[model samples]
Target: MSKTISFVLNGRQRSVQVDDPEMPLLYALRNDLGLHGPRFGCGLAQCGACTVHVEGKAVRSCTFPVAQAAGAKLLTLEGLGTPERPHALQKAFIEEQAVQCGYCI
Candidate 1:
């Protein structure tokens, strides 16, 4: 059954029709919705690369099912900062030069 689930993504109200309840939110965000900030690293939820804020708490998007994200506010890397105005963490990362290779900051 293709069910439509609505949620707040990057501070924007968005919805997606999904058939499987076990489909991870990461795939839905990247493939379906086109939000690609979070990278895929260890789909088993071992890596922190797929970190995203779900209702003010960091969560592993790789394992987070889209069904669970329904009606919840999701803040990915895109939402935390922007090109014009970056977040404090982003600014700190730039200042400290903390990124090494594709760190998915």
Candidate 2:
């Protein structure tokens, strides 16, 4: 059975129905909420592509259980900034042209 998991997503309070509490937060963010910022790299969490900010700290969403995020705040790449006012790192990356495929951007 699916259970509702409530959390703050990019500063907005949101809830998602998770069938398995052990389900990765990546799935909830992508399949459920339709977010594309976090890439699905190595499903084993060995790669850094599935990184997301949880309560201001980086966490591997691919292997992170959705239940563990209840009531916590989450931030994805898209939440980092906007085109009009990109984040410092974002601006630096653009200036340096240090991005390709954007899997870990």
List the candidate 1 regions with Cα displacement exceeding 4 Å: 103-105
What's the distance in Å from true for residue 17, model 2? 0.6
For residues 1-105, could you state the per-residue lDDT of candidate 1 as single tens digits? 799878999989999988997798888899888877888988888878888889999999899888998899999988988879999999999999896677554
Clashes of each: 0, 0
Task: Kindly list the per-residue Cα lDDT of model 2 for residues 1-105, writing each as its tens digit.
Answer: 879999999988999997799999999999999998898988988888889999999999999999999999999987888999999989999999895775465
* Residue 44 alpha-carbon offset, candidate 1, angstroms: 0.7
What is the alpha-carbon lDDT of model 1 when measured against the actual structure?
0.88
Candidate lDDT values, in order: 0.88, 0.92
TM-score of each: 0.91, 0.91
TM-score of 2: 0.91
What value does the lDDT take at residue 86 in candidate 1?
95
Report the poorest 10 consecutive residues by lDDT, candidate 2.
Answer: 96-105
